[model samples]
Structure formats: structure tokens, C-alpha cells
Target: MNSFSKLRFRQSIFAKFTFSFIIVGLIPLLALSYISLNTFSNYLERYAVTNFEQMLLFASKNVDDLYTRYNNESKLMYSYGTNKGQILGETIAAQTLEGDYRLTRTVDDFLQTVLYTDRHLQSVFFVFPNGAYQTVTKQNRTFDFRYQFPDREWGEVLQQNRNLLSYFPTHLDNYYLGSNQQVLTFGRNLLNVVNAPGVEGEIVGSLYMDVSMGAFDEIFQQMMLNSKDVVYVLDQNNRILYSSDRASIGQTYVQKDSNEYYRMQKDNANVAWKIVGELYKDELVMRTRKIINTIAIVVGLCIVSLILVAIWFSRRFSKPIRSITREMAKVESGNFDTQVTVQTADELGLLSRGFNKMVVRLQSYIEEVYVAQIKQKHAELNALKNQIRPHYLYNTLEVIRMSAVANDDNEVGDMILSLSHQLKYVLDYGQETVALQEEKTNIEQYFRLMELRYGEHKLSMDFRFEGDVLSCSLPKLSIQPIVENAIYHGIMPKSGKGTIRITAEELADNLLCVTVDDDGVGMTEETLHQVRQKLESSYSLDSGGSSIGLKNVHDRIVTLYGPDYGLEINSTKHIGTSVRMVIPLGEVNASAERHNS
Candidate 1:
């Protein structure tokens, strides 16, 4: 059964087409569903966390504003009293001296009025320096007068920092009997106003305000999205002052498991506390899972329908393809006379007609275009070889002439050697481009020959090249012809010693410019114009004048590269002549290197 299945997959177009349609349709559907699900989940998670952070920030701000209002009220005890211009602090201080029941009743009434202003305030206490205290409460609870003010740690802290307010963490109300309510406390010492200069006032007594956790609960209730959401208000030491879960209050808030929840936190601006919110992760995943399952079901239905359609289409099309395949096999065996019969007037018929036409044209092109190109290439190569032979013969004769002229001169032997090297380079048809350094060496050899020939003319040469310019590539024998022209036309005609400066430098747009300047007899403006006109023209008859070498160099540059690159000439009659040649740099060098390799 497995072998039969493999044979069906290999030979039957219907089976192959069905499998291809299934893969092409099913894989992308699965991949797209997976990607979309992940993307939606991530976006949903980020959006939820961002909203949670904003809610936490709003809650923190509300908590800060509440604490700030209470802190300001605590300072109001130092304000001047409503009666007789006496400060409230001084009145509270005088209660220590009066020791009367009516005065104690008046003070208690004032504290009760302050407590009634905010429903969150649970109790207020004013403890005197002698450990005697007065208190008020929201409910009728008996006071614990036996609780000594000087004995508690919070009392000592307030007594030490007389001018600053101190905060106490969440604790039960121990100062009142039968009151087990949780409260956050603030305490400060009241100071005696000093009228005499340099007389520091003493501490009359300390004031304490107790705030209930209902204040935090009311603010957090508005921000809860669901019951499963957790909110916590923590002190600087990570101790929970208030939480949605009441059992966790007064305990340290350890971080929940991060993989199962999204948590956000903000710090209260008015106090050293942090507000935190956590949301469940499974809720977000459930939403994404439903979308993914729907997509998967849709994709499965599409795959099954696609397989049925592919089977019908493949059966209809495979017969025409099989006929074309048989004819193509005949063509592969060099039977160009074969043709496919047009079975239907659809694309299959058009393909059959196109195949017949293509075979006929292919046969004709093999006889005409292919054979002619080969013959033309052979003819050109042979003509080039014939032209190189005469130049080789001429260089050989020149070497012999030099040897015959000065046999005793040691420099003549060296000249012959240089000539032979020049002949070999000139005849090397395999390499069309050479490195700039090799061309420079060839110019030096040519200049040596000139020096030997014109012994009394006193010709000198100098080369200045920029960084790595010598490693660049140019057409072989390109510079030597120009250098020879400069020596003959520019230097030989001058009256005094002549100096030739050759400079190579890089230019913009990946170009290289090589300039040859000679301090010799230069051309008049009219002559220079004529020379430029001849170089710029597309065709010119050979005149064998002094500018022939210049024209040759210009033609080779323009032919190899485009017309935008060529030789440029500038000359002053009394001063010198400058011939600048521009050529492309990096790409040309790479092409030349590839050809050589």
C-alpha cells in the first residue's frame, strides 16, 4: 500500500496537484492565524497594562491630595484664635495651667469641630507636657487615660522633632478602650510663640490625628475593573497600609507571580507610599483562544474544498501537457520537425502554436545568427594578429639600430633591454588593461630612451601620485604615447632645459585624473583650438602631425569608456602645456581584474 501511494504521488498529476493545493492553502492559513493570535494577545496585554497604570496613577494622586489636606489642617492649630487675638497654641497651652473642667470642655469642643469636617477622621488627641491629655472620638468610647504619652516610641519621635510632623504606620487604636479600628496616625509638637527676642519657646504639648482606612477604600473602589483585580497601597518599606483583600492588610506585600498576572505600580507624590494593581492573564488568553479556534475551523474547510477543485482542474489540464511533453522529448533528440496538435481553443491551443513557431525560429537562428557571429569573431581576431606583427618587427629594428649606433655605451645595452620590454608589452593582446604602476614604469623606460637620444637637451621628469592611485587600472600603453608626445612636441622645441610633471589624483564620482604638464614650448590659442576640434570629432583623417599621439590617447579613452571621459588640454604659449585624462576608477579596475583572472 505504501509503494502504491508513493507511485501515485510521483506519477499522477491529480495527486500532486491536490497535495500542492493543500500545502499552499493550509500552511499560510495556519501561520497567519498563529501570527494574528500572538499579535492580538500582545496588543491586548499592553493596552490593559497601560490602562491599569493610568488608574494607579489617578489613585495615587487622590491619596496624595487627601494626605496633603489633612497635613495642612494639622498646622492650623498655630493659627490665631477667634476670641481676643489669642493664638490657638497659646489657648491650648493655658489649659495646662488652668486645670478647670469648663476649660477642658471648651478644648474638647474645638477638637470635635475639627474631626466633624472630614468623615475619614476617626479621633483627635491633645497630650499635655505633664502627661495629661484631652481627646475626642466619633463614637462614645472611653479614653485610656492610663496610656502614658511619654512612654510610646511615636511620642518620643514627635518630642525630639518639635517643629516637624511625623507619620505612623497602620496600627490598631490603642489609645481608646474597646476600639480595635485600624488607623494611620500623624503627630507633632505644638510650640509656644516667642515675643521676647532670642527667647526660644518651649514645647507646650503634642497633637495627634488618627485617619481610618476607609479613605483609601473609597478611592480604590472606583478603579476596580472586576472582583479578581487586586489593589494595594504600601509604605516605603513595602508594608501594606491598605488592600482590597482585607486579610493582607498590615502584612508585607510580596510581588505576585509575574507569569500569571499583569502588574502596574505608581508612587504617591505626597507620601512615601506605592500604589499597585494586578490583573489576571488567563482572561486575556481566553479571548485570543476563541479567535484562533474559529480561524482554524475556517482554514480546514477551505483546504478540503481546494483539494476537490484542484483534482478536477488537474485532470483536465494534464492530458494537453502530456502531449506537449512527448513532442518536447522528440525536440530534445534533435527532431525539430515534430509539432503538437492543437486540441482545444483555450490556452493549451495557444501554447501548442507557440511551441511550433519557437522550434522553427530556433532552427533558422542556429544557421544564420549563430554561425555568422562565430565567423565574424574569427576574422577580427585574425586581423588584429596581423596588425601586431608589423609593430613587433618595427620595435625589433629600433633595438638593432640603437645597438649599432653606440656599441661601447653601457646605456645602449640598457636601452635595448627597455625596448624589448616595451615591445613585449605592446604586443600582449591578451591583457587590454594594466595597472597604473606598470604603465608608469613603461613611461620611465620611454623617458630613458628620450634622455639617451637627446643627450644635450637636458630633459627631466617628476611624478606625483595620490594615495593608492598606482593600483588603479587603465588601458595598456595609454600614458606612454602621451608622454612621448609631450617630450617631442613640448620639450624638444624649447630653448632651455625642460621639466615634465606627471600627476595622478582621484576625482569625484569614482573618477581618476592624470595630468601631464611640461615646462616647454606650448601652443598658441588658435593651435590649441584646432587640436581640440580634431580630438572631439567622431572621425578624422590621419595627418601624422604632433597631435596624432594625443588624438590616439583621446580616442582609446572615449571608445573604452564613454564620450564623457577623454583628454582635456590647456596650454599657454610661453609657459607650458597640460594634458589631463579622466577615466572611471573602481568598477573598471574590478572588470579588468576579473578578465585577467
Candidate 2:
């Protein structure tokens, strides 16, 4: 039964290979062909839509520019009152008997001479609030002089209506050689008398543009021939005012009084005007079908040719490829012992040889990494020992000091307790800095112990803490070594009791200030200056007695805080000595400091 199962499994390989090959090959071919078709279609569709939006903006800008030009001209005309910026300033004595025709004639003379010759302009008109009007046609034709006021001339449209700007029904059948023309009429209300007071103010003119749809249609036709796109022109309300396809013009592009995005406008509302462009969906669909057909033909022929070559090479390629794949599988599974055994003299053989060498190198690297990890663990263990053992010693000493207290040796016990407290403060904060208050306390405790040991050694302590200064932190051993320097060099060498006064205060502008003053056997001017200069500058603490005397405090401050915060010294010979420090002030929150760092 076992041998029968082995025979059946061997047959299953051929069946699996046929099924897997069909699936892998066909799925990619079909999906890739579809993607190619859709990609081209989408690109063209988006390209046309983008072009349409740009065209919309361009047309809107043109209208705005034209309106601004006309408005500026009226401003120049209004300035005629005092000839502030006018070419010809005139004052009329009478309002009515001065004659409406006279003012119309004056404006007409300028329009005919300056405006009628311009190419883009179609017409210019002057409208009086009395409903009398005059116009000059820019078109290349002649007509009756009285026909210049086309009855629907802007003044007559607002004869009884007081709208600032209005669009009214008008006949163009008798004008323009009896041809029907759709016109977009824009108007501005002008005063009849420049700077007139109250009801005396009259409509001067309605400067308007009656845009012929034929001009835009011509431009649209040219565009449609060159690029398969549609463009729509919109008014301030985003209503479709014009379209490349004449049929879509005058239709509502977006619904009115609708809140839904799809039901509302897609573009901005404050815009003076807009142009919207898009390609036809049928054009995109047609292109997609062409793309799919082209891909289908190309892929079918490619597969037919590749399959013929694949059949011939399949048996020949399988042996080496299968061997390489198996070797890579071992590498993936982290079995570096498996070596590729192919003996070809081509690039494939070179790759196999390189891979084998890489596996050997990887094995060596793994072994070295294991050894390094063991060494790292050993170093970490030693560092932890260094950090914890000092604290244990301090705790033991504290226990001894308490025991002495129980034995009723008050003087001995108190001295022991001071030393023990100082030791614990130092050891418990071995790798950390302590507050300025704690540093002073530790220094005082050390002083008590020293004084206890030497009965004749008398010293007076004068320490004062000002507001917000005592809370500032300093290195744990900062004050201790300085105190030791005084005891050894200055205080001890002196003949009588010495005074050690330490003061901590905050400067008015938020700075930490520490001063340690000692009236012991102070050095001469030259020596004191040298000490100050040396402590201010940087040098190694492992240098000399100078280093032990001052560099310890300097290095600790600079290393923990920064260079700006190192020790500063000032002194006068035999008068006294002071060591000062200014460090960045912060309450030590252990976790926050570590996280920020």
C-alpha cells in the first residue's frame, strides 16, 4: 500500500503542473489586457476634463478684464469735475434747456473717433435717465442716424424700472441685415450729470457689451475640430450661459436651492464667470474598445510564439532551474549548509559560486555575533555591579549609625549619623545629580564628621537660601571636593577658627547663582587669579592638585549640564574666596528627562 501511494503521488505532479500553469499564465494575461485598455481611456478622459476647466477660467478672466477697462474709463470721466485726471473738463450751466441732444452729441463724438474703430468692440451707447439715448455702431455697416438708439437701448429698458443693471427683451430682426442673433448684454448705470446733487443726478450712459454668440461659436468650432472636447461658459450663478453645443446653452448646469454636492455646483460661486469643458463619454468608450482589441491581438500572438520556445526549453531548463530554486529554498529556511551544485560555465554558475561563499560568510558572522552578545552581557553585569554596590555600602553605614544611637553615645552617634547620611546621599545618587539644597546638606554633614574627628579644628557655617534658588540641582559631589580643598589648603593651614559662608540666590532674570566664600588662609592676588582662570577654562580632572582642587566641580557641572554652567571663581588675597556657578534650572523629573533626551 505504501509503494502504491508513492506511485500515485508521482503521477499527481504532472496533473498539478498542467492545472497551475494554465491558471498563472491566463489570469495575468487577461488582467493585464484589461488594465491596458482602461488606462489609456481614463487618461484621455481626464485630459479633456482638465482642458475644459482651464478654458472656463480663461473666458471668465476675459469678461472681468473687459469690465474693469470700462469701469476705469468711467472713473476718468467722473474725475472731470475738477479736471483732476480729465483730458477735457466742461461745465454746463443749465440741466434741461442745456439740451439732452447736446450731451449725447459730445459723448458720441468721442465714441466714434476713439471706440468705433476698435476691432473687439461691437457697439458703444450713452443713456440719459430721461430715457433719451445715443449709440455708435462698431460693425462694418451704415444705418439711419436716428436708428442708433435701438428702442431697447438700456435707458428705455429701465424707463420705469430702477434696477441698477437689467436684461430686457429686444428685437434684433430688423437689425443685423434681418438675421437672428443671440446676444449677451451687460450694462453699467452711469450718472447723466457728473457730480450732480440729489435728484439732479441723471443717468449719463449704460456702457454695455452685446456679445454675439456667433463669435464664441466660431472659437468653439475651431477648438472642437482640433481637440475632441466640449466647453461650457457659466454666469456668476454657475448657470450655463453658453455651450459649445448650442442646444445645451441656456440650460441650468447645477440645480437651484439644492444642498447635495451632486445636485449643486462643482465650481466656485463668487467667480465672475466660468468655462467648463469635458470630452464625450462615447469617445472614451470607443477608444477603450480599440485598445482592448489591439491588446488582445498582440497578446495572443506573443503567447503563441513564447509557448513554442517555452516547450523546447522546458525540459532543458528545468534541471538547472529546479536545482537553483531548491538551494534558494534552503537559504530562505536558514539552512546555509545546502550548496548549489550546478557546474555551468555561464553567469548562472558564477551566481551559484558567489551564493555559496555568502552562505559560508554568513555562518562565520553568526558565530561572531553570538560571542559578541556574550561579551555584551558580561559588560552590562559589571556596570550594574558598579551602580548598586555603593548604595549597599551607604545603607550598611546608615544601619551602623542607628545602632550607635541605640547605645546612648550621643556625640559619637550624631557624628556617625552625619557621615552615614552624607554617604547615602552620595551613593544613592551615584550616576545622578542632586539639588543645590541637598548638596549643601551633604557638605554640612561632611563638615560635622570632619570637625568631630579633629577636636581643635573649629569652623563656623554661614549658609543662606533665597527664593527659588535652593531647588536648583547641582552635581552630587560638586560642593564636597571644594569644601575638602578649603579644609586641606586654607582652613587646616590657618592658626584659628575659620568661617565658611555659602549663599544660594536667584538673579532677577531667572538664573541660578551659587557662592561658596571662605575666610581661611586665602592665597595671594597672583595665585587667586591663576585659580580663577584655570577653573573657568577646561582641563582634565586627572591633571594635578589644581584639578583635584577645582576641576572636579568644573567637569561635573559641564558634563551634566553644559559648558556654560561650569565653576567660576573670584577672590582677593587674605580677604576671602568665592566659587560661583550658574546652571540651567529645572526640577528633576527622572522619567521626563530620560524621555526628552
List model 2 lDDT by residue over 531-556, tens digit each: 77677666666667543657777877
lDDT tens digits, residue span 309-372, model 1? 7776776678778888889999899988888876553345546666776666656656777777
User: Which 10 successive residues of model 2 have the least lDDT summed?
Assistant: 256-265
Error of 2 at 189 (Å): 3.6
Name model 1 segments beyond 4 Å from true: 1-28, 98-101, 144-151, 194-200, 225-231, 253-265, 276-597
Clashing pairs in 2: 52-277, 56-275, 191-204, 192-202, 192-203, 192-204
> Each candidate's TM vs. the true structure?
0.44, 0.38
Relative to the true structure, candidate 2 reaches a TM of 0.38
Number of backbone-clashing residue pairs for each candidate, in the order shown: 0, 6
Steric clash pairs (candidate 1): none
